[model samples]
Target: MADVETLHAIADAAASLQVLIQDAIEWKRQHLTDDLLSALIAAEDEGDALTADEMGEQVALLYLAGHETTVNLVGNAVLALLRHPDQLELLRRDPGLDAVAMEEFLRFDSPVQMSRRITLDELTLGDKTIEPGAFVVLGLASSNRDPRHFGPSADRLDLGRVDAGDHLSFGGGHHYCLGAALAKLEGQTAVGRLARRFERIELAGEPVYNGRINLRGLASLPLAVG
Candidate 1:
């Protein structure tokens, strides 16, 4: 009974969030005429264009996926730096390392911990054979830390890691995140600027987790910056 009530509450909160996002999408549709939504609406592929609902869905997806991922990326990066003052100092000394550092951050603590994919055909992975139509959840976080792909120091955060960008934080191929470039730019700018401006940064209290399993992030990160 309690579990059912909790699930209902969660569903209610999600619905409310969707409403808020849709409202914002509508507002953007009306007021803004020069953004991604507008572009998507105006986009044509061999005379085929997206309908109103399709455009709305695209915008909502961007808001849902891009917004939280970027927020969590920045938050997680800052938290990592705070925990590793030496690395933070290195970044403060050389802001150019932001791009590499961002890659390492994504690899060390990916915002999207896992991704889902439906098997189109029977496939064998190790000893397990997944039948067609089976839902497969790939552990992106685990893959990022895989020693075979990332070498001996896979678990460590090395900002200057030459192969850091090889991580699957943004996925790959056609299904790669559409807003990957934007997210990287925002993360680099935000974390780099923060490092450059703040002489000191420290956690003020215990951080609060979002409690989401797939999307790992903090709900609140109390900090003192100077």
Candidate 2:
């Protein structure tokens, strides 16, 4: 997931992350003879067939997706709260709103904006017929803001929004994000602590966006905090 093409960030940071991915495969290869994972699989008779590429992909998926999702979610959530003081106050006054606020944060400004899938069968969605085998892109962020499910305040930020949990930010079904739980927990912790800890948080300067469509996030949140 640290593919340079997908993650357009500081080159140095990107290089360092890429190195981590490469090291994971090398580390596995170096300790293959004594690796606990291999030993466990062998004990279960599953065979030692996981290839280096597969291992790298898994590492990449776990490292990048999990980390980036929470990073973006926390940053975006904080920025959103800063912009909406009413919601920020609610979060600060009530610790119970931490989990619920995370959902709205994910919905209001999704960290991962889009998800792709191949149609299994010809289907009509909003009068557009998509054939089987067709490449389809689902706009998770757009769906999250749809007035249909979220009512007229869909476009607005509502910490206690009833249907915020129905958001597609974490995707859906079997292909849903594996790091969804981790991301939520991290987001809740980060956002909750910030609201409770800081007396004031406001945008100090212009916010910097990563300018990415898929994994969109704030590159930097220039803030005035107290």
The C-alpha lDDT values of all candidates are: 0.87, 0.83
In model 1, what is the error at residue 112, expressed in angstroms?
Answer: 0.2
Q: Which stretches of candidate 2 lie over 4 Å from their true place?
A: 1-19, 22-45
- The most accurate candidate by TM-score is 1
How well is each residue in 1-226 modelled by candidate 1, as lDDT tens digits? 3598899998897678667766776676567586776566447323556665565566668878989999999999999898888889999999889999999999999999999999899999899899999988999999999999999999888888899999999887779999999999999999999998988899999989898888899999999998
In each prediction, how many residue pairs overlap at the backbone (N, C-alpha, C within less than 3 A)?
A: 0, 0
Instruction: Return the lDDT, model 2, position 18.
Output: 64
lDDT of 2: 0.83
Where model 1 places Cα greater than 4 Å from the true spot, the runs are: 1-34, 44-49
State the TM-score for model 2.
0.83
- Candidate 1 RMSD computed on C-alpha atoms after optimal superposition onto the true structure: 2.9
